[model samples]
Target chain A: MASVVGEEVSNKQVIFKDYFTGFPKESDMYLTTSTIKLKVPEGSNGVLLKNLYLSCDPVMRILMQRVVPKGFSNYTPGSPINGYGVAKVLDSGHPDFKAGDLVWGSARWEEYSLITATEGLRKITHSDVPLSYYTGLLGMPGMTAYAGFHEVCSPKKGEYVFVSAASGAVGQLVGQFAKLLGCYVVGSAGSKEKVDLLKNKFGFDDAFNYKEEHDLDAALKRYFPEGIDIYFENVGGETLDAVLLNMRDHGRIAVCGMISQYNLDQPEGVKNLMCLIYKRIHMTGFTVRDYYHLYPKFLDTVLPYIKEGKIAYVEDIAEGPESGPAALVGLFSGRNIGKQVVVIARE
Target chain B: MASVVGEEVSNKQVIFKDYFTGFPKESDMYLTTSTIKLKVPEGSNGVLLKNLYLSCDPVMRILMQRVVPKGFSNYTPGSPINGYGVAKVLDSGHPDFKAGDLVWGSARWEEYSLITATEGLRKITHSDVPLSYYTGLLGMPGMTAYAGFHEVCSPKKGEYVFVSAASGAVGQLVGQFAKLLGCYVVGSAGSKEKVDLLKNKFGFDDAFNYKEEHDLDAALKRYFPEGIDIYFENVGGETLDAVLLNMRDHGRIAVCGMISQYNLDQPEGVKNLMCLIYKRIHMTGFTVRDYYHLYPKFLDTVLPYIKEGKIAYVEDIAEGPESGPAALVGLFSGRNIGKQVVVIARE
Candidate 1:
């Protein structure tokens, strides 16, 4: 595989500049040029990948912050940024993958990435669908929604499901999945456009623009008259507090992410947690990494929905590696309405 | 069953004069004498009870306040304050109960209570144990501890357990139960006296006085150097926030009560909840009432421990029904050392 070396070419990469405190800005990361051998080093046990599509997620903000929380690693200042991405294998020293194999997993944000940690990479078996779907609908975010909804929320037919940031990457899929399970799904988003997308396009039973609602509790009560049984929590803070008050007995809250609290120096104080006791609510937080074992099952369940046109996905794609900083930062300000993706190259 | 009858007698009752806010005072309740015929109505099915022991629990404060939370009914004004109590059935029109039967369930804080809702009542089977034990060790609080620690927390042998307000009725039992499962148990109490009782009497592995510790997170870190496997949340607010930070991956938090938040106008906001997402923690809140259906199973498991002196119960007995208000209020101020019980009549 090392024999396919081309002439020395400049490989563009996004570098983490410094540790961030509050909200991360575009300047927090800078572009740099580097040279790659275009091949896996001799006797090296790793895969050489040509990056195609990069995923811009909220967890990136936490990785950019000064002190990373426990069980999570921070991006090094001088190194290239790493995230979930779609890539084509150019060279492979590992037996599982070979050249020309398109895969999705953790990768460095550069034209070419030498992935030493290649165990998480999944080989693309179905090419009939758009390859970029591996970065979202078939990738980390996909598995997240699949596992978070089915295993975490433990949804039952006709149960009331409420999702926050419902038009975002993971939340949108959760709403659709809940609807498919025969749940009465309601979603809350920041804008009318997102809310409309949730109801009209994604098949949510109802949707509301949280920004317009002065009283979140009242808005929730209006949407969920009997109270919510399953809450797919993507945005935390005020939304979480309100949901706590409106959850039904034996309710389940799958805390997938707290996108609202990531940029803040101090996360908002949730005041209605006592409601958890009275309602006998179960709230759990999880990461997609732990659920990758179900990736095969997830694909089997979700692939038919995609091929049959039963599931709809919206991606806000930015072209070229130069657009990486803006594409990532736009997530914090809700500048991107749906799943934020950055395309580096085509096949 | 309504055969017993007696001449009219002046029944001493504690009546709720007004709805309370913030902290309840003795003035919120006043003594009233009412004449009773000491017999059930000829056509109606209700029990006439002579109250023996009343359990003063923290949740009573929430019921006494103006606004009741969902899933919990509030005590009405101009009515006797009701709580879990042990009583002697003077007369019963229900087929399940009869005159001279000993029962414990929802009963009024008065000398004589005409119990219309007797479905929650459990007839005493084990007369060998002290009858007052029904209010603390063998009744609501006992079932609360058993179900909370076993069913909700799912304690495994050699696991690390943390109990907040550990010398109180439910907390004391939780610590002992955790120890019985061969888990390493630590407890936090308000006073050094209670702390000592947790370690020396309740068989806790370690105990700390939360009042003496300025930083709860630091205190928790010192006690749980490795991490907490399960947290029995009897006291919420800051303790909950700290426990969130120190929890191990997949830790369980059984929220039985939030005594610290019951008296506050606005419950304190929990700030470190993001740990839940990072550690993949599970936090659930429940009540003993929901688990009461397992009462026979619980008694079968816990009764032998009591008989063998493996479980110790400490009670702060208020001499008479006149001491009810002070005994109940003392819980918020940390006056009572253990389970607060008001004795009405012995036997």
Candidate 2:
């Protein structure tokens, strides 16, 4: 490929139009095109990235709301929204990154982004796996499952583990990780296909379609007869209330995200929280950003599993930058089967 | 005192008439008498106790309900309800206890109790402090404050600590313990008197009457401008929901008790729990029984403070065995200003 120096290329970007209160729609964000110089600015330690794959995460919904929840920064209206993504370094003024280096971390949902904050950017060393995996299974969601389960839930062999939103990005990996740890893992998804994927593809001991279950408490009782020792909470609300009653003594709940409640104007009230005292349960919330220091150790542990075909990943890819809004909005409606990703440019 | 072995004496007792729902009343229990030989039966390890001071705890109310919560054994109807008390060993078949040894542990709400389950009993080593303190400051509540604060909350020096129900048995001590660790401690109580006790007696940095504060979230923000580093949760419901919003990143909540929700048929829904994830908080529920192994170490630390007047304990004493029902029921209504105790017989 010939270098196109000082040339302006049309950069399509997703922009936040307005803050949302309840469920977000495609109109909440607008797609706009502008031209960008495909080169780093002079004398700046910034990396110019041609965004390849953008991750559509549930936490982005929280950032889109008018009042950003505590400990989170909101996306500015009219500015390009940024999230975890895989990008190729088109130009670099930074010491670590150079041209042609494939990197992933935080990137704008646009064709090109001049990233001044490149401290957290991880340089991709291996391309044996799909590059898109850097946006899901090998990226933030994977680390979330790894850290939330091992560090927060503290699973022991033969312990009963239950995960909500089990077919989603983090839940799928958590169920698999729990199974690998010799735990009895059960997962709950919204659709039958996702449920089947959980039990069949992810090797979960059991899986249920939560949408079909009218009585969540009874469903939990049927699955976790002895009681759940670890609950990887991804979809909070009634599921949490049911799981509370079914938790064993000293049960651990690793609250990764509450996707079910994210878009609701008022999140459902958890009524059985008193069970936390009765059962001596520990409920902790965590983020992958805190566990980034252990990325190498995490890779060492998970990479072998991937190579051995012991670990499986499922991705729901949206074809182009134009599909970004619908793909991101699809998460709140439980429309995505697995990890939702928007592909801007394959290279 | 002479031993009256063969004589049948009237053993006045507070008997649970039936299981209760919602708030328990004094009428739920009735006074009765039964003849006892006042001697330990042959070939039995049961220790006979002359009940001196009975500790009125919120947990007893749970045991009195028809459906008992998990991890706790229910008190039987038509039987003497048992609780923690200071007692004198009248007759003992157990090796550790002898006649006239002052002890504090599980005892029936009666003048005399035949304790078959004496394993949890602790022989009182210090009579220099008030024997009544055994039921509150020196017994279960003291150990609860010690373990829940240091072990569960993991307090750091100069941390901003908030305690709910701060004039109550465990809360009073938790506030003091946080202060001893060089933390700035604020406390909330239901009454102005209790609030005064928290600030004037317990030495809390600040105290508020939660009853007067219509907006709990605003009150918390007023107290914790920067954010709360630790919350010693004794009262749950609205206070918990408010504190969740005021917590700093990685703040811990040691759930020692939820006195506010114990009597409710349906516990209050904590709406702001999503804040747990937003702030990466750790909310853990703990009971003192699990930390009893550290009792001796706890005493070594707390006893000095009590003896030196560094720790002040307030007790609301109900005179005689006849007053047992009212003192026990007073806990639910927040009528008792401090540690509620019924003095059966001082011996």
Candidate 3:
């Protein structure tokens, strides 16, 4: 393709209208075409990039709301929304990055973005595998699962493990990692299709459709008869309470996320927390950002597994930046089967 | 005192009348006098002990209720209630103990008890300090504070620490321990008297009465202007939710007990748990039993501190075995200033 000199290039960007109050709607986001110069600005230590693929995560919805004392920074209205994405460098002024370098980290949801080389951003030198894998299976979600399980859960061989949202991005990797450690892995998903994937595809010991299981306590009892040694908690609420009742002595719960209670006016109460006293369970919550230093170690451990088919990954790609808003919001409704990613521009 | 031959002695026993529904009442525990021969059965390994002192803890209430599937054995109704106490051995068949030997461990709440030589029991050879210290300052609660802070919380010097129920048995030790580690310690109590004791007696950096503070979040903000690094959680519920908002990056919460919610039909919902996702806080629950290996090390570390007057301990001693029921129930009502103990037959 010939470069159009002196011509303003039109880039499609997703912008948040205002802070969200309740469940977000598609109308809350506006996809607008904006003009950007093809070159990096002079004296600016910034990298200009064309986004290839964007990750659609549940946390984006939390960033859209205004919470007291500010739980975290929210996306500014009228500004292009930002999250983790894989991009191709168009132009750069930083010494570490250059034009044509493939980088993956936090970036704006647009065809083009001007981002400073932040501490989190890293150049993707090895793309022997699919580049889109950086958005889910090989990137943030993968690191989340890896760090949460190995570092937080600290699973030993023969431990019984339970995972919630087991077919989703982080949960899928956690289930696989637990199985690799010789653990008896059981997972819960919203639908039978996802449940089947957990068992047949992901190689989990057992899978249950949480929607179909009327009695959560009974379901946990049936699945974890001896009791769960480790629980990778994604969906917290009654499931946590039920898991509490079935935790073995010295059990560990790695709280990655509480997706079920995120959007509720009032999160559900946990009635069996007193069980933590008797069972001496360790229920801990952690995030991927704090464990980013282990990313290199994580890649070294996981990349070989991916290449040799020792580890499997599944992605549900939504084409075009226009579908980004819907793709992100669809997470809450259980619409995405695996790691949800939006393909902005394929290599 | 001369041994009365062929004469049966009257043993005053505190018995559980039935399963308690909610908060236990004195009526629930019936004091009955029964005759015993004051002799150990032949070939039996049980030790017959005259109970000198009994420690009353909040966990006893949970034991009074019918057994739930919490993995541990619950106290049977119409049986003698048992917990940590300092005792004098009246007679013994166990090789490790003999008559007149001082022992501190789990024993029944009666004038006399026939206890088997269990693994948890230990003979108290060092009487350099008061024997009652075995029930509180040097025993289970002390070890709880040590393990929860050092092993679970992993405190660093100059880190900000918050202890709930600061004037109570475990909380006082936690606050003092955090201070001794060069951390800024703040605590919360139920009344003004307890708050004063926390600041004056326990050497806490700052203390507040949770009952007086209408807004717990505001109270936490007032104390922890930056953020809390470690939260020694004794009273959970709203206090936990408040602390969640004020927790710094990588903060740790050691969940010891949730006394505030013990009597509630439903546990309180925690809203700011999502903060864990953003801040990457590690909130973990632990019981001291799992860390018993550290007891000898704990004694080495704490005994010297006590002797040097670096650590101070307070106790509320009730006069007789008949007062044991009221003293145990008083824990729920915040009626005791410090560790509640009943003096049955002090050596």
Candidate 4:
């Protein structure tokens, strides 16, 4: 068979079964092979993407739950589940993208995806870094950590910063960013290995394993004796409640995600919110979509740090889409260390 | 004894007996008549106050709690209960306050009090408003409403604003401010009469009795189909949880007080805090102390409104210091309408 611009090709896709109840499992999604034409649809300004690397994020669980968050669409059943990914444009009807152009944005868990929403998609300009970095450090997660830390939290020098889920995709960079900005940073992770990575590798002032602590408030007091000035909230629920108690006066909490609460049929109740008044805390929730305009500035700041080895990122990469479901489900159980990713095709 | 520089005067006081459990009742405090000097002491920069009007606030319950919030001290036993009040400076050893000065600030619930902490004291300027107004509409609660509505909530024209505990001192002003700024204001009170006061007297576009509604979320949905843009949170716990679900994207919640949770041994779990993330909501807890710098500006904005009949104020005046305990305790039971104030003397 000769290669053609508009020829049919085999597309292996992960299909979401349905909106789930308490916790999601690998069985919630199934893989299937389908045929797709290697071209954009007629009269549509869409781009044909051959997805290379897909990100396994905690937010996908929220989109999969019964009620999808505002500003995000639900993953319809019998359709390919989608998230941020690295891809090559095989064909384009949009002016900004063309054949062979490398890009990263919203992509389906399939071999090929025709993305009609072209605005969210951005062409990958710098090739010196690994293309897979677009799925973690240089893409949505990176932007999330950047905007959440610098813009939302409005951190100042020598502030006491605490990051929950500190060894994961966004938290690791937030700790690093706070440290770079002359802040005293502490992090909490589930495993000892991740804790060690946060303290030694990520330059956190101190790190603790949250799983070992029965009293989160006491653990936080041990780490942040003077109380936390900034909290980069990743895993919510009980952690958030404890963080509220330990927050300093006028503390700022940049809420990026709540992985712990995502799987619950009823999200855990947070009781210490009264501290927000006593401490004058500003707890704000935000998404990367609102901060995409800062991408250029983020790249300028982060690319240098990455090149100079000032920033370190770790990826737990699974080989293929067959491993995607387990890898995604494992996030709830703390199975993946650092940023979780699955490669559909490395190219 | 005849009036002299340091003559002793009989001072009737409301003394807090002890920090007791459950709801604050009249028995938690008792009346005691003690002798006090009518003059400020030598070598001390204290002002001798003749407390005329005392404000009964929900925060007094918090100060009486086992864990007093930071920046606030617990009420020591056998001492007169202190809160924001209107007082006359009978004698002063400080230059800022002189003898016969009319002032309003932190005052003890006694006929005479030597206020050593005189920095918080402010000499009443515009006497055109009722002297009793210093305890409610033009005093600390007024400043609280002003700073909270203008600075914290950051409202805009045509925005949908909701005020909880709407018939109370702070909530009433907040609703009026939102309405005066051309915003659609809805209020939730504990009683039907208070609800009527909010809608008819306070100029709220809509009002609801929170106790009457079985489902607060459904109640809010009925009033605000477009969702709340700003929530002036005076009553917390379940009401806050309900408001979280009914908030629009990027909504702001100015947490003025948590009257509902103050007496609870364990605050109710707010399950919908994740709504903060889903809606990109900004929920901030604040005390009037942080915004005291805006008092002069607030006076400039609000004084004329009070004078011109643009802002309506309602007070549930409980006459005499003997009535203080019941008036203050009645706040928890929602027995008092509007601002609950205790008048010690008219002149």
lDDT of each: 0.90, 0.91, 0.86, 0.90
Interface RMSD of each: 0.8, 1.2, 2.7, 0.9
A1-347, model 1: which lDDT tens digit per residue?
Answer: 13255445578999999897888889999999999887788898899888889999899999987798886789999999989899899888999898999999888899888898988688999988887888889888889999999999889999999999899889899999998989999999889899889989999999999999999999999999999999999889999999998999999999999988998888899999998898999999898879988988998998999999999999999998899999999998888888988998877
Candidate 1 chain A vs. true chain A: TM-score? 0.97
Assess candidate 3 and give its lDDT: 0.86
What is candidate 3's CA lDDT for residue B342? 92
Residue B6 lDDT, candidate 2, scale 0-100? 47
Residue-level error in angstroms, candidate 3, position B8: 1.7
| Order of quality (DockQ) | 1, 4, 2, 3
The segments of candidate 4 whose C-alpha lies over 4 angstroms from its true place after superposition are A1-7, A41-44, B1-7
Candidate 1 segments exceeding 4 Å error: A1-4, B1-5
Mind giving the per-residue lDDT tens digits that candidate 1 earns over B157-232? 9999999999999999999999999999999989989998998999999999999999999999999999999999
Per-residue CA lDDT of model 3 for B63-128, tens digit only, reads 776755464467877777888999888788888888888889898888877787555578886889
In order of lDDT, best first, we have: 2, 4, 1, 3
Error in Å for residue A240 of model 2 = 0.6
